[model samples]
Target: MTSHRYAQWLRDSAFGSLPHPAISIAVTLGYLAALYPGTLPRDTTITAVLTTVFSALGACTGRVLARRSRGRPEEQARRIVFGSCLVILGSAVGMAVWWQNLIRSAVDVAPAGVGWCAAATLPAAVVVVAIVAVPRTAAVVAAGALALTAGLLAPADAGADEQRLPVSSSAQHDPGTLLRGELRVGEFDAAAADLARSWTASGGLSARAVVVAVPTGSGWVDSAAVDGFGSRFAGDVRVLTLPYDQVPSWQAFVSDRSGSAESAIAVVSAVATVLDSVPEHERPRVILYGQSLGAVGADAARVWLENEHPSLLDETVLVAPPAGTVALLSRTPRTVLANSSDPVVRWSFAELWRPHGATGDTHVRGPRVPDAPWLPVISFVQTSVDLLGALDGAAGVGHRYGPEQAGPPHPLRN
Candidate 1:
């Protein structure tokens, strides 16, 4: 077709509401794209959610491309569109098989069988059909599906004060006991006071250093980090964490990021108050720690500490901190532990155009996936997909940290 005619088609695709073969093919392509695997293997639930969400989004995208014009394509355009769709779909299918197998092999997981694939794609197909045949109903279904997904992904401990008893009663020998359970939604200060009082009663003030850990959105304190703290400090360190929310991390992140920060500030303030009661020469060092969504709170707490009581804050440790939210530098010593394979640490939109981890910060660790190449839009899509299974990877990879995550805080520079 001539350039003028091609421009006209483009306009029609962008504005017209006509049901074009190209639009349908595009929607199919989107569903197929969602089937391609990322850095980790996915379970059936993740597979269905990913496929359905992407399919619905793809339908909306297709609508935008073919929304305004009701004009039908020419015979030649129709033939060409069909031929192109075959080539594109065949390529996508081949890539889907290869990529899924590659990722599963890398993660040492069993390959998903054909039955699993069919079952996973069924929901996506249904959602796509609804979108094409009944747009309003499809919108409601998509919204509900997303809400259900958020709820399903939340941790078991999300939202309730039912605390998991410590493996041992001794907080020194079993720092995991320091979890202290969660408070209700708006009583972070009260929870902090209670936690501080509990720690003081347990002889926590005698430790060489006290680390206040910030739990993730689901009130999860990493068992690995707790164990590491106990082992590294040789029972001379106190670890304390305050739970802030019961929702999934992403939901909390979008709807109430400041709440996490407020929770951290409350805990830090409470800890600092207790430290003030001890003699200046005998006061224990204070180290702030957080991981993932916890890191968002830790970053905020670090800022509050820097401004309100700089002397009380000795060091900060952030593991797999979300890319955009973390403060890279600190007035006090700080360590940033990030795996190169972790999408949570490197999947910001800025990565679409520039390489990350190039900043001259001493704390930023290098990439673990040395051979992985960064492509413009492709990398973004790959990482976005990877976010779905980030926690499924083994320790020290993706979003999973090992016991080393609780290592001693960064030493101050001379």
Candidate 2:
């Protein structure tokens, strides 16, 4: 009698844990929605994140509705859920073919077959189901175990200082008297003065053109842009970079941006002062170049130039500036390079309600999606999620820009 009672309790518990019919329907719809196309191709990791989030939301909502409606007969619930499953599965198969064709045509990528779709969605669904069906204590324990395993298995990166040491070294070894320096917090004036002195010491006052290449948050100046400058000026120009932060661009973008702004202001000011001392005929053309978060800093410097010294800057090149960041210095000769598929240049809350490509000033680049329709809130959500993999695409696509970023501000037609 005792063993039979124990077996009966186990069976009841298993049956009770089965998801309600509402949950099956909700999660299926949510998972299908996650499979919709976006600006970039969704890889397994991205798809998993989207699937898990949507499924969790659906599961919670379904559980609440089921509880409020009280219980239904088991046979009726089973029939409804089983019928819904067949319909959903059929829709998923059709959606998979359409999704594959859309991504292939739009991005020129190989097919993401139905297998890929299943691989991306199934594991995520299982994980979400485990969390939703398990008791709170068991769920917490599983999550903790997973985190610990990940921490143990994941590779560790070098320390921040170690990563930064190489930037200065690389700049020194690059061609054409490329000078790399750092900006000191609370010592902008002193740093600027020292930078001016360095320009004089390095014989840069004699160059016909000087390019101030502002680095992103991690002090990374694009080598292609530097080489482009050399090609543009016949190796007669001086390229100076004064980097500020040591953290990655995304971290600095979210945490503190004042460093890039302050450094840009100081370096440009210092370079301008030194150039002013030279004879007018001998003064080098001042060209400012920045990419990603660096563009934000360069924009700040442009504003400062407008107020303090109106005609100091000759031209500016900004690559992949964040969404909604406009060029305030309309008077200055400006070149903006943006890829239509670049999430960094298009991710914004405004996309939730309006069409993209509405900006008149931005020059959109190629490898663009041919048929990426902008659907109100869906586009916004997909774009926001795509930010995680913005840099994953090849050069000239998504957030990656090539040496063309260094092309002349105003090109002459052939």
Candidate 3:
């Protein structure tokens, strides 16, 4: 009698856990379905409403089965069988709708492949349901163990290829001249490194040039930027790493306030002070470079320089300027390099700017390629990996921006 009672208890426990596993599976499917971008070709609203309804039904069925099993044994058994069927059917319907719609829409192409691959484990799903319905704790444990083993053995590469590349020694170069004035406080070092690399990669055009690297992200840190690219400039490249920390955060300053413009004004004042201190022949040509969030900083600098210190800036390069910044720096001849696969730039252009009315040339898109010769304006496209790698301080040849492959015999007509 005790053995029979133990067996009954085990069965009850398994029945209770069934709904949880089912709900988990359904939730996973729903998440995967939502990852598909773009509008649904069919009535998305109806499809979405139905998907939610089926998910709720599956959850409710599981709960009813778990509760009914604890009250009347006969009723519990009936509900268990019926509830399992409903849960399975509901999940199937949801999956079928999602799968069918995915096949019909181009946006769903990637997700469809993923979903079909996930659905290949239908046998495992059945085993999960069985384990949940079983009352014996030992049997439930065995089933779980089996499920885990099957999942582990599924065919897939578990590791990624790890490789290393030679590090660039360009991060040790020094600034030939120091612009004497109040430094724009911020992470100037990071921006300086990128500018230095660009200057060096351009065969030393940055030599002896006053490279003004505006700080748009954080406190100015000139060590990284200066050390990275300073050694490659042909002449002494004077780095004026702006310190923009007088404000709270760099992001807040760019988004909420006009601190960047104010910072640019301060930088302009410092540049004038430096130019005045140096002999007429010793003054370097000013080249401005900024990236990512710093692109906004570069924009503010361009506006300030063109409007206030026009004589100081020789050329400006704005790499991946934030949306709406194009107009800010439109009057200044600028080169905007964007990552072809960068979601930030793509979304910003497609959703943000296009919806509103903003007109600015997108120099490059698709993949990160070598820099093209567009006279005073040069645009370089970088791969996502290359861009992220460079940003993360990874030393690699892939991170280097070189000359373009093919283009017109000459640069774009001025």
Candidate 4:
């Protein structure tokens, strides 16, 4: 009798219906705790990881039973119900993370609870939609759309409030009109042409010098710098900055950088090719300048600059170059105005990639410049208060090299 009872317990435990609900409930609870954060830790990394693993497990279990689903309605229904609960819980957690971040940014206070269930019915609604939705194709597309939306809506860097500006009319040096976001190459040319014509009318070509400036992430042109160049150099110093290939975000900065660099080469080359056709005396000395991602664009333009027009760009001014800048074109004699405490520019130095080393060091693109006795021409400036500044704002506060930091005669003004 005892042996038979132990055998029965083993069979029940191995093929038990109990495991399904037990795993589901534990996963659901973890997700709930992560998503709700009512009085829990604001840091959601651990819970987010837990919910992700459980959701994946639930999905795998459902898929394993999919082949036999038609034969057993009851079993199929159980798996379906379990998977549905995991997804439902996941949506709740995603929203909670978003909400908690938002409120924290707004009030600058610690949230008391795990997170506010501002919309308590959100999870139920998501589950209902998921159940009724047909064709897994739609779900895949929806998931992609959700990710894109989240990336696009990410918060701007600090001081964004003061930095946000539409590309508009200039005060002193006419930096072409304000650019709209995500422009095609042709559209950019058209805008540049319009601005060039205006610049010519304002005695631009007559001054025999031009400066093309790139704005920050939020499309802010350094009016002060442009204005300063116009006043200090006694030249028209025309400035033309551009918008992004798409909505700006830190995550997609590399793609944005690649696009901006390609565009810069094309637009600047076209403009320069035309200007170079003029008599050497009549041709304006073309200069390049960019801040943040635009600074990145400046660095990337080096590949083409060296390949196509080695001496076309006479000078360059890059302020607060972000991480991943490997500007190898020392031929342009560029000046990097960095805030010593700014992690943005500092990260660029730490971003070492040699021809032989760790996996991250495997950059097969042309020559490795960082180790090449590289004269970065960096002018690092900082103040006492800059120690606490983040990568984005340190340059402005510590180094005082912001858009408004213009007005002084820039080193390239010579």
Candidate 5:
């Protein structure tokens, strides 16, 4: 009887422990999937699916190990559940980190299809793991992480093509309006006609309005200068592209400059110049739009406008502004749109807080406007695909300072 009881105790304990290698390998592969879904061939989607199944099995095996090591049935169940939850949480964090890294890379690499694939699959995989494993605590954690990941990484498809404004036949009449130019900084340019088209399309606005887009990084291309604004605003809008390399004078102005900070100053200065040059009467209700590095540029410009030239800015929009800029700038009346799910923003906050003991709340100092009643529009695109798609499709364009959409416009104040 004594030997049998000892044997049972060993079995329960063994069942409660997880397989370290299995967890390690699954987590590593999951992260890789989050980073480069296209690295696996289309033929390999099945393989990827199978790998996830194996991961689930591995998790179960760990639970079994835990169950075996503990003798009491209730205790065994608790241990199994707890261990599974931890593993899932760890996997989720790993995936989020991987996704952020992938996005930063995709800004330079193309055939962006890979980035899209990764963005779509990472969250789905997390869901599958949660459902299949089904440990109560683990499932809850997996769900939360999945929600957060989807919110961050899934918006990629929405704005992938947002480099230029869409040009219809009407755009041809204005020769001066058809500015075909490009700016080069290091490896990136401020604007491209194709990107502008994508941007216009994403906003659901007619490509025939006065639109102004600012692409900040490396340098702004002529396309960014002319087409981005001219095509949308019908030559009424002036696109001011600020190339990072072209701003030596402004670069000297920022006291302790990081590359991002320099880019911000350059863009703000460029926008200020454009605003100054325009005959106030001809300037269409100016809307400032920025993405990624451009977001930092937009934020900086908004700050400058608020501090130095508040009269010049009519409306402003920033997508995925860097955490540093978000932290530094004061709240303004501009409409700021951000992705709650974006891993880049999240990770940036994590990096910031890890060193400085700050919270994500520190970066929340933007205008409170919601997506409607546009005087100072504040919109938060929920999904990556939707945000990117709106930017690409011209669905996200236009300047309406009133309520026209279905959802309650996110109020600017509160």
Candidate 6:
């Protein structure tokens, strides 16, 4: 009786325990659908069904692994296989949610409010608990989760924000001579000034042009743009990066987004302050960049990029700017880079409100490779591993943007 009770206890805890796993469920399905971006139906009904089935399977697999993990090698093998599936499915769900939200709504993608951040990270936690019966698999899941957590924080970068730069030093800075400098006041203002000074110091800014970059959800400043654009961009252009104090919650994310938007506006304002001190010929031109939630903040500041000043913010370059980004004023030279494979850039359905956008000389939609002929089986297998590519911070043609195998020439500069 005692042995039977112990077995039952193990079975109960392991099985049927993902009662509130919607967050995990969404992420898992989305990642899978992304494998064959063009091949998949991309319908919410399909995703809803997949999420339900995946959740049920997760519950079933967790239980079976828990019950049979202590059995013979064959049973342990089954546990390993099941445990592996759980982690893969969780990522697939994430991909689906990401795709759908990109096509759906930019501002409130993934229901940004209340307990959203916990929902974002909980699936991995759930996986850890479910696979505990298999020590080896458990370790793999835990390690993967830990690595993801690290990438999900401030990405490896070097730049100055308000926390590092101050207003007093603003007068002393020169755009042509600075390398890595400091910050103060609103994060965007301090960083923008730093870039302005760097450009002046380099004495290489082309037409005084610059690319103002906005960080992602984790406040990761994009080094890709800075490295890719190079000096002709500013003679010595400054990739003026804006900082949003990220606190790891939807409210905080949203709050930071609003602040980042306001800060983006303020950055423009700060650049204006510094530029006013210099001659019109010496002032640097400005452009923009953002991704995921960063796109939300950067895009929200689109108005400043438009009217009120002819020379300021000559153009706008938005990467995966999200659903419902307002179309730029007809005259604004803007470029929007999007990927059909990234739900973070293009998921939409009837229940979801996908905002309309502009079609212009600068719009590009792709994943480097043309979508393969629709094959559900192949797509699923492809995206399963592709998500790992996303976790590593980037990819050539999928969700996260990396090297463009082939794309337009000089988008921001043009």
Q: In TM-score terms, which candidate is top?
A: 2
Question: Candidate 6 regions off by >4 Å?
Answer: 1-52, 55-208, 231-235, 247-256, 277-282, 326-330, 347-362, 365-394, 403-414
TM-score of 3: 0.44
What is the C-alpha lDDT profile of model 5 across 1-414, one tens digit per residue? 698897887656534343334343444443333323211112224333433544454555554554565353454555665477557646654554354345334332223355444444554456445533456766677567558756764323222223433323211222444322234344222333333443333331322223244443333332433444443444543343433433321132233224444444444444455446656765445455555555565566567667877776665655545445554434554544433223233323244223212223232322221221111111111121122222221212311111111111342221
Better of 5 and 6 by lDDT: 6
User: Cα deviation of 288 in candidate 1 (Å)?
Assistant: 0.6
Candidate numbers, best lDDT first, in rank order: 1, 2, 4, 6, 3, 5
- Each model's TM-score, in the order given? 0.68, 0.80, 0.44, 0.46, 0.38, 0.49
Q: For candidate 4, lDDT tens digit of each residue in 57-147? A: 4434444444344553455555776788768776865666565555344324355344334333343334323422332653575577559
Give the lowest summed-lDDT range of ten residues in model 5.
Answer: 398-407
Stretches of model 5 off by over 4 angstroms after superposition: 1-212, 216-232, 245-261, 267-286, 322-332, 339-414
lDDT of 5: 0.40
Model 6, CA-based lDDT = 0.47
Q: Which candidate is the best by lDDT?
A: 1
lDDT of 4 at 225: 62
What tens-digit string does per-residue lDDT give for candidate 2 at 121-185? 67656765664566475467657866875776453221121246343222243556577774465
In candidate 1 the C-alpha lDDT for residue 156 amounts to 38
The digit string of per-residue lDDT tens for model 6 on 288-405 reads 6666556666666666756556566566666765444435443666666765554334322211332323345335554333344434353434443333323222343445464331
Better of 4 and 6 by TM-score: 6
Q: Quote the lDDT for 321 in model 4.
A: 64
The segments of candidate 4 whose C-alpha lies over 4 angstroms from its true place after superposition are: 1-154, 157-182, 185-194, 249-255, 348-413
Q: Backbone clash tally for model 5?
A: 84
